[model samples]
Target: MDIGFASSYLRSLFLTSLFSFVAPLLLMGSTIAGLSIISYVPWLGRLSQPGFELVWAFLRTFGNGNALEGSLVIGSTCGLVGALFDTYIFYRQNTFRR
Candidate 1:
């Protein structure tokens, strides 16, 4: 491949890889933050305890049975893992490229 072509291709790949790794965590963190804020409401609080509610329990277990910081920690860890997964997928895609 030509030098310029290779450089551009690498730049694109780098950006894609970076975005894939960061976007999910940012989205997840924002969602978790928004939900945490919304859960302060009385009625919606009740609706949040079936599926994603375990986050609270997990957070509580981490701290003094409280679900704020713990949730963030858990969510961040999950996000990091997710980012790693994205990186792995990028690697695989590049490896299998035609």
Candidate 2:
């Protein structure tokens, strides 16, 4: 086994994990901010109330329980899967070339 190859792969895997984890949190934060802004829009607020309630409930359940841990686990799993897929594709391409 090549140490350099292994290290490079691990580095990519870590970056993938970090990106997946951060992207969702950023999206969630932006969503919350947008919703908060919308909540003050009078007519729009009334229209969005039920949807907001549902979202709030969902967040309360997941966000309060184990959101951070869950996100980490999910992100790592995704990264691993992506890395595996990439490795498979690379091998396939090399095999074809050889």
lDDT of 2 by residue, 1-98 (tens): 49986797768666765676567666656766677789899888986677666655665565456555544555466556766776776578668988
Best by lDDT: 2
Candidate no. 1 TM-score: 0.50
Which run of 10 residues does model 1 get worst, by summed lDDT? 49-58
Root-mean-square deviation of every model: 5.7, 3.5
lDDT of 1 by residue, 1-98 (tens): 68985687667656665565566446646767777777788998776555356654655786577666555555556556655665677578768996
lDDT of each: 0.63, 0.66
Off by over 4 Å in 2: 63-98
